[model samples]
Every structure is written in C-alpha cells, then in structure tokens.
Target: MSNRGRDTRTARSRWSLFGPIVAVGTALAVIPLWLDHSGVLMGVAVLGLAFACYAIGFNVIFGSTGQLFLCVGALAGIGGYGGAILADTVGLPVVVSILLATLVSCVTGGLLSLIAVYRSLGVIFTGIITLIFTLTFDALLLGLGSLTGGENGFLIKAGADTFLRKRIPPYYVMLALVVAFLLLHGLLRRSHVGWAWRALRDDELAAELAGIDVARYRVYGALVGAAMLGLAGATYAFTEGRVSPTTFGFAQVDVVVLVMLAFGGIGTLLGPVLGAATFTIVDEILIEFGQLRLVIYGALVLLLFLFLRRGVIPTARDFVAKRRLSQASAAPD
Candidate 1:
C-alpha cells in the first residue's frame, strides 16, 4: 500500500474508535428522565460526573505525559475554595468565580510541572512534591477556618437562588462539563499536541531527540488537566451548596479519582467516564454493606487489578484487535 493510503487508514481507524464513546457519553444527558423521581440517585449521578472530570484531567497529565499527580484533590480543592472565596467574599459572580478558580488551578498545575522538569525529578519524586502540597492544603483549610469554615465547610449562598442548586439542573450542568472535557481530549489527541504527548509518554529521551519540547508539552498537559479539575470541583461545590476540607480531601477525592482512571483505561478517551460510572454504582451498592464497605472496596480493587489490569476499555480493544488479526491471517487472502 502507498504511504498516503496507510496514513488515511490509520486516521479513519482512530476516529472510528471514538464513535462509541461519544454516543454513550452524550446519551448520559437523558439520565434525568429515568432518575427524576429520585433526587438521591440523581445527586449521585452528578457526583459521578464530577469524578469523571477529575479522572480525565488526571489522564492528560499522567497518561499523556507520565506525570503522576498525586494531589488531584488538592488542586480541585483550590478550585472549590477559590470559587467560594471569590464569589462570596469578593462578591464576584458565580460564573466569573468558577472561571477564575479554574485559571488558578491551571496556573498551579503548570507551575508544578515546570518545577518537576526544571529539577529533573522522576515520577516518584514529583508525586512526593505534590503530596506534600496536598497535606499543606489540608492544614490550611483548618488553620484558616474563618475563611474556609474549617472542618465543617460552608454553604454556597451566591448561587442558591439560581438553577444551579436545583436537583436536575446541576446534573445537566456537570454532564455538559464531562462532554466538553472529553471533546477537549479528542481535539488534543488528534493534533500535534497529541503526537507530542504520545512520543513524550512512550519515551521522553527519544521524544527530545526527535525535536519535541518535552518540558512545554508536559506543562501543557498539566495546565489543561488542572483546569478541568478546578472547573469541575468549583462548579460542583457551588451547586451542592457546601464546601469543606473533606469535600476535596486527598483520601476521599484523589484516591477515588485514581481508581476510576486506572479502571477505565488511562490513555483511552472514554476511560474516565466508564470507570466513574462503574465505581459510582459500585459505591451505591457498597452502601448497603454498612461496615463492610471497606472490605468490599478492597476486594473489588484486588479483582480489578488482577483481572483487568489494563482496564476494561484497553483490554477489550486488545481482544477485538487480536480476534480480527487472527481471522485475517486464517483467511484465503
């Protein structure tokens, strides 16, 4: 086959993979119709979307550029508290506050990435740096209780009268954010940015030798991902009408987000959404177990790691590819 033909085939195959993801992802919009009668379930769905947003952003940083950002919750907390302070204390509009908070997260993420690159820190060291930051953020939340409401958190008065607090509207709002995050990832995956990320992730040294700006691309991934995390956290906090240290605590939020992305198939576009949906339901079911929830969680995590290490999506893709290849090899051709 000609080089042009091969390139065209590769592009077509790449896009075809997203057809299912986009279809199912957007189909989440109609979830309200089914759960309209149950505010509790609908609320869970909204939380699921928020988690999905975090996982997607994490994927961009970790899956794309090999940055193990252990402080997903800390960065997201920045957005949540940032939004609360700006909207309530500073008297900014809710939308404006959320946007500004997202930018703050973006800048923070970029700075972290830049520092890692400048210091030539490996993945583990970079994670340690972010983990310390997370611990400090948790401390600040308590030490500066007047502004953050300390341990108890505070109500969101700014958007209370808006539809944002409505049970169904907030779900749709978060759903929209998830779709937009997915779309953004798709755009990056198709562009030269995606190319740089693939190269950088696969082999940083080779990527540098091949003329890719490793530092710049790494920073780009973090900035975009952190923006998504911030926007999701801030918007969800305001809509839920509460902001507390526990809301974005590393143990509560970051651990769950990590599990979701890992189970979803990190680099794949739909992994975060798929993983979030699966775990959200799993969590709801685990609620019935009361005290055994932790045990069940451990069991489930063990099973996931043992059987689906590459995650549901990547493993399934590998299976389908192998089947097709075998059939082609056995054919008359």
Candidate 2:
C-alpha cells in the first residue's frame, strides 16, 4: 500500500475505534438522569467506576509492567482499614483519612515491590509471595481484633451533612474519583515513566541496559497502582459506612482484579472501564438466579476467554487495525 493510503486507513481505524467509546460515555452520562431510582443507579454506576479504577491500577503493574501481584484484595483492605482507622480512631476527616489511606497503600506497595525486587523472584514466586502476604495479613487482622474489629468489621461514620448521607453523594464522589484516577492514567501512559514501564514489560535486561532503571520503574508502577487501589478501598469503605477484613479475602480480590482484567483486555486503557461495567451489570442481574447464577457466570466468563482471548477491547482493536491494514493494502495505487 502507498504511504498516503496507509496513513488514511490508520486514521480512519483510530476514529472508528474511538467513536464507540464516545458514544458509550454519552450514554453513561445521560442514563442516570432518566432512571427512576436515580440514587441507586448512580450508586451502582459509582461502584462500577470504583472497580474500573482498581482494575486500571492492576493493569499498570500486571498488564503494562508485566508483574504478577495477587494481594489486590489485601492492599485494598489495607487502604480501607487505614482510612477507617484514621477516621474513627484519630478523628481525621473522611477526606483526609481517604488521602492518608492512599499514601499508606503507596508505602505498602513500595515495601512489597522492594521485597519482590530484592529477592529476584520470578513471576510465580512473586505471586506466591503476594498470596502469602495476603493470607498473613488476613490472619493478623483477625488476631488484632480490637483494631480491625476482626471478622465483624469496623463501622464508618457518615459525613455530618444530611445530603452526604444519601446514596447519590457516594456515587458522585466515586465518579469524581474514577475520573481523576483515569485522567492520571492517561497522563502517565504518555509520560516517559509510562514508556519505561512498557519497555520493562518488553524486556527487563534490555530496559536495564537502556538506563531505564527497571527496578525503580517497577516499584513506581506498583506504588502508583496501589494508590489507585487504596483510593478505591477508602471510597468503598466510606460509601458503605463500614469495612471488614473479610471484605478483602482472596475470592473477592481474585474476582475483582482477575475477572475484571480478563473481561476488559489488560493491555489497553479502556478495557478496565468496559470490563467493570459489564461484569458489574452481569453480577447484579444474575443474583436473581440464586445458586445457578455463579455457575452461569463462570460458564460465560470461560466462554468469553475461549473466544475473546485478549479480552474485549484488545480483541476489537486488533480486529479493527487488521481490517484497516488490509483495506490499505487493497487500496488503488
């Protein structure tokens, strides 16, 4: 194909891919306005947004940086606990506690990354270590009963404002947070640090040779990702008005992090948002089926994986790009 033709085809393909996203965003913004239970609907929308944030954070480390982390739930719990503890025990404002939780989660991520890098562990080993850390943290929380409230969990005090108590307030806060975190993702993806992360994912030794400081970049990615997770956790706790160690168990972590990533297409930016929305809707609606819901959900996910190997967005983008390339090649000289 001629260069001109190829460029035109590529431009068209990019526009085609982005068009759907714009349409979807329009729908999301408009739908809430018309819903009968606007508050509940908005709350669900906010929860989906929160999940998207958490998934994107995971994407940075696991998808972009090629790290295997399994303590997603534990880290989120740490964030929630940190926020709740500060809000309740130390009398910090909810907003301050939430910010503090994010910082703490960053610290936690840094410590975990340090251990991973220092040990020179492979992916599987890192996964195992993370799993161990998650389990140990759960045990510690259970043992620390007084602080964590053990299995019973801790209660969060609602904000003083009456309007803040309404479900819509939480939804708005979460939506704002999701937007902020996602904006950060977009900025980071275009930055030097983001490219370094992709390079590290491509080849650690080569990235090291290129003076990318692979370990530092990896740690930074982890910290950034953890910050997002922490924000999600803190927001979730505040919105729910409570938190428990049980909330961050292995299953919840695996389901939210892995399932959402798988559904969203890990490498691409839109995958998490799309995946979280679809998964949340599916989960919510399927609850009516009782015992069969889980079975059906698992089956659907398996089928999706089998057919859409790269998850939804990646697979679609690949398809679009390939088609555009073909069209370019077939164009008249």
Candidate 3:
C-alpha cells in the first residue's frame, strides 16, 4: 500500500476502535440530566466514576506493565489524607491541597518504584513488596489517630466550600477525570514510553537487552499511575468530605480493583471504566442480598475468568471485528 493509503487506513482503524467508547461516554455524561434527582443514585454514580478513575490508574502499572503493584489503595490514601490534612488542618485552599496531595502520592509511588527496582524484584515479588507497603501504610494511618482521626476518619469541611459539596458537580468532575485518564492512557499507549513498559512487562531481561531502561520505565509507570490514583483520592475526599482507613483498605482497593480490571479486560483502555460501572451498579443492586452477595459476586467473577477471560470489552471488540472481516470477505467485488 502507498504511504498515504496506509496512513488513512491507520487513522480509520483508530477511529473505529474509539468510536464506541466515545459514544458510550457521551451517553453516560447525559445520564444525570435524565435520571431522577435522587441523591443516593447520584452518589452511586459519582462513586462508580471515582472507582473508574482509580481502576484506570491501577491498570497502568498492573495491567499495562504487569508489575503487580498492589499498593493502589495506599497511594490513593496518601492523596486522600494528604489533601484532607492540607485543606482541613492547615487551612489551605482546596485546589492547592489537592495539587500537593497528588504530588505527595506521585513521589511516594516513585520512591516505592526506586526501592523495588533497586532490588530487581520479579512480578510476584513486587506484588508482595507493594502489599506489605499497603498494610504498613494502613497501620500508620490508624496509628496516627490524632492526625487522621483514627477509625472515625478525617473530615474535610472545606468540601462544602468547593464545587464538590454537591452531588452533581462532583459526579461531573469525576466523569471529566475519568475521560482525562482514558485519554492519557490512550496517548501513552501510542508512545515510546508505553511501548517500553509493555516490553518490560513481557520480558524485563529482554527489554533491558534491547537498550530500554527497564527501571526508568517502571518508575514512569508508577509515577503516572500513582498521580492518577492520588487525584482520584483527592476527589474522593472532597466528594465524601472525609478520609478513612476502611475507605481505601484492602478489600476496597485490592479485591475490588482486581475484580474490575479482570472483569473489564486488563490492559485495554476502556476495560476499567466498563468494569467499574458494571460492578458498581451490580453491587449497589446486590446490597440487599445480605451475606450471599459475596458468594454470588465471587461465582460470577470465577465464571468470567473461566469463559470470557479477555474481559467483556475486549472480547466484544474482537467478536465484532471478526464478524466485520467475515462479512467483508463474503462480499462480492
């Protein structure tokens, strides 16, 4: 094919990939306007979007780079508590507090990467180290009761003074953040850095042999992912007007994020979003299932792994693409 024709084909292929995602996002954006003005529903929507943002960030290091970093919740907690403290205790402006909080989380992630890369840990080993960091961070949060409000949590009264005080505003803010993260993920996926991370994920030794700085790229993934998680954390603080240990604890971050990413299709740009939305909506509905909710949810996830392991989004995409190709092949000239 000619260069111009190949470029045109590539452009068309890119649009074909993202067209559905864009359509879905546009529909979701208008949902608030049509839905009943119920605070509870809106709260659920906001929470889902927040989790979506968190999952996208988590996907960066875990899914894209295959690092198995399990400290997403801790990183987010750093941002949440950092923002809460700066805004509430130090009496700083909300925006400034959030910015600083994001920076703190990013630095924390980078530091962790530095340590892990220094040890040259493998994927499973890296997960164990990050998990230990998560548990220790959780302990520290509880230990600093005076600062973090202990089990009761730290409330951000400044939330009321900001746009986050209202449900709709926060929902929109979160939706915007989710879109930004997705765009960033897409851009990175098409860049050299993203290719380096993918190479490292596939084979660290080979990547290094190919002259790619594995450590540097790993740190970059950690930095980018941690920054997004931190921003999500800041948004969570303002939306809920509080930060607590249980909020970003093991069950919330580790299990939930894994489930969402796995269910939505790890390493895919829109997987986290779809997974978050599906899981959140179903979870809210199943809240009345009492104790059996856990069993039912686990079973569903197990079945998904057994059957649609590539994740719903990726599986559907592949199916559609195949059908289109088959149809095109069958067409007469």
- Could you list the CA RMSD of all candidates, in the order they appear? 2.1, 3.7, 2.1
- TM-scores of the models, in the order given: 0.95, 0.88, 0.93
Better of 1 and 3 by lDDT: 1
Question: Model 2: how large is the Cα RMSD against the reference?
Answer: 3.7
Q: Among all windows of ten consecutive residues in candidate 3, which has the lowest summed lDDT?
A: 16-25
Relative to the true structure, how large is the alpha-carbon lDDT of every model? 0.90, 0.79, 0.88
Q: Is candidate 1 or candidate 2 better by TM-score?
A: 1
Task: Write the residue-wise lDDT of candidate 2 on 64-162 in tens digits.
Answer: 777788888888888889899998888998889989988998888878988898887888998999889899989998999999898999987745454
RMSD of 1: 2.1
lDDT of 2: 0.79
lDDT of 3 by residue, 135-234 (tens): 9999999899999999899878986866787768888898889888888888898789889988987888899999999889888988999999999989
- Stretches off by above 4 angstroms in model 2 are 1-27, 36-42, 158-164
**Worst lDDT 10-window in candidate 2:** 158-167
Candidate 2: clashing pairs of residues: none
Candidate 1 wrongly placed segments (more than 4 Å): 1-18
Instruction: Specify the highest-lDDT model's number.
Output: 1
